[model samples]
Target: MGAISVKSKHLLGLKGMDRQDIADILDRAAYWERQPKVSDALRGKFVANTFFENSTRTRFSFEMAEKRLGAEVLNFSAAESSVQKGESIYDTMRTLESIGIDAAVIRLKPTGVLEELAGKLNVALVNAGDGNNEHPTQALLDLYTMRKHFGEIKGLTVSIIGDIKHSRVARSNLWGLTAMGANVAFCAPDTMQAPELEHYAPFVTMDEALQADIVMMLRVQLERHDKGLIRSAEDYREQYGLTAERAARMKPHAIIMHPAPVNRGVEIDDELVECGRSKIFTQMEHGVPIRMAVIERVLTS
Candidate 1:
């Protein structure tokens, strides 16, 4: 197996990652995708998947990646551990490190905690998803999918529509894509937009967003919003959803994507999810190799 190199000991977020580093990760992911189902790249290394919040894709993907690379895996769930009885996240991490874990894949509900943990923890830290900060692996998989389909990321117009304020995927994609020379636009209702990102990418109308080469939809994160901020799913769908009509209007070569747990007809039409242009499942398939590349980088870099 080929080695993936990165300067950072921890894969915190993509906010400051250089373009060449992102390209290397994507290229390494492609290599992993084409390899046999398993390898011994990380043989005998101990990695812990520590998730304080609930997850399906990120957790499973990381575990699969770890196993495929022949690493010894420890799965940590907050609810089932001492964390339930008041053990702090830092204490939990330290405990794992004390047990000789070489690296950790963490998903927590709080932002900035990963950065703090990265500083004090001896083991390498990989951010699975932290609050709404960034999910670098997701963005890396996304960039891989885009590149595989389009042959390059440069000059591709990617429109991210829906709940931008609560989407770590969007933030990571924004930072990664822009670094790789893609143009990004945000489209969302006023309450759903992240004003802090105004200087980074313009928030355009839905019609203008459809003109992009890639239309990526985000889940309507009702749990993150104040109750009643979104009056109804129907209301949000009519205004911001990628309905069938909207999908039809997109350019013939344009593709649709969602970092799922899709809300079906809410953020996007149900049928359009598996449509010719949709890369939803393809994105999931890419996650394993993308994460494999990341884990290999962290453990072996």
Candidate 2:
């Protein structure tokens, strides 16, 4: 795929996006963070939150971002729409476009559909999440969090630990972090590993994973896996969870992160979720500004 133009209106994913484009969005996010809570930046525009999958954070975060920018918002749920009656995602999106939405923040269960929709749609398309493909805004907020803490992304080490085989967060983080010069690593059980991503980063042990500058835990997506991969929550936690003992061994400056709705004790210990070194909630706070920047950029640029 070609590099995304600076003026590219759609934020499909960060996989092949330009390094400078990522930096620009982060920089703009910092600016938005400093401004007042609301603005008329996107005034007179119509933005739709069209989700084909269930989401809490990403969906609400995009809605908050749109409202902050003063864009009129339309929230769409697959269950409440004609999608339940067998309408295609493409047709649903087209219907929104026909209704004069200037942009669409979409989350779908199928991969590659957003890319096809981006090519066919007249309005800007922002990827909220698409299967295990990518979640650009989540990655952007993550990068923003890291940059806010460490002051730069280059030379930092980020270890993403958990179900790599079914994580769009891990994939987006891998692409964006690598583009910004961070060394990325994956730590997961054999069955949870993504073979396709092995060439991009090394698969390390729990000890090696904890040694990185950033320790990101991914939610164990039990829904995507068969019954045998993980026998029980306790078993999975003992093997891969960021337990208190393991967190104690991490470097003094390393921070913890997760793209939530976290699995509490399954992927990370409950206490560590809000520990001093954890940036989980901070990541959520940054989501609004990062998404505001993305929405403003797509609509105004």
lDDT of each: 0.93, 0.92
- Residue-wise lDDT of candidate 2 within 1-301, one digit each (tens)? 1112356888989998777999989998898899888988788999999989989778889999999988999999999999999999999999999989999999998999999999999999999999989999999999999999999999999999998988899999999999999999999999889999999999999999999999999988766446677877888899999999999999999999998989998899999999999999999999999999898878865
State the displacement of the C-alpha of residue 90, model 2, in Å, after optimal TM-score superposition. 0.9
Residues 68-131, candidate 1, lDDT per residue (tens digit)? 9999999999989999999999999999999899999999989999999998988999999999
Q: Give the clash total for candidate 1.
A: 0
**Candidate 2, residue 89: CA error in Å?**
0.8
In model 2, what lDDT does residue 75 have? 97
Give lDDT for model 2: 0.92
Error of 1 at 28 (Å): 0.6
TM-scores of the candidates are 0.98, 0.97
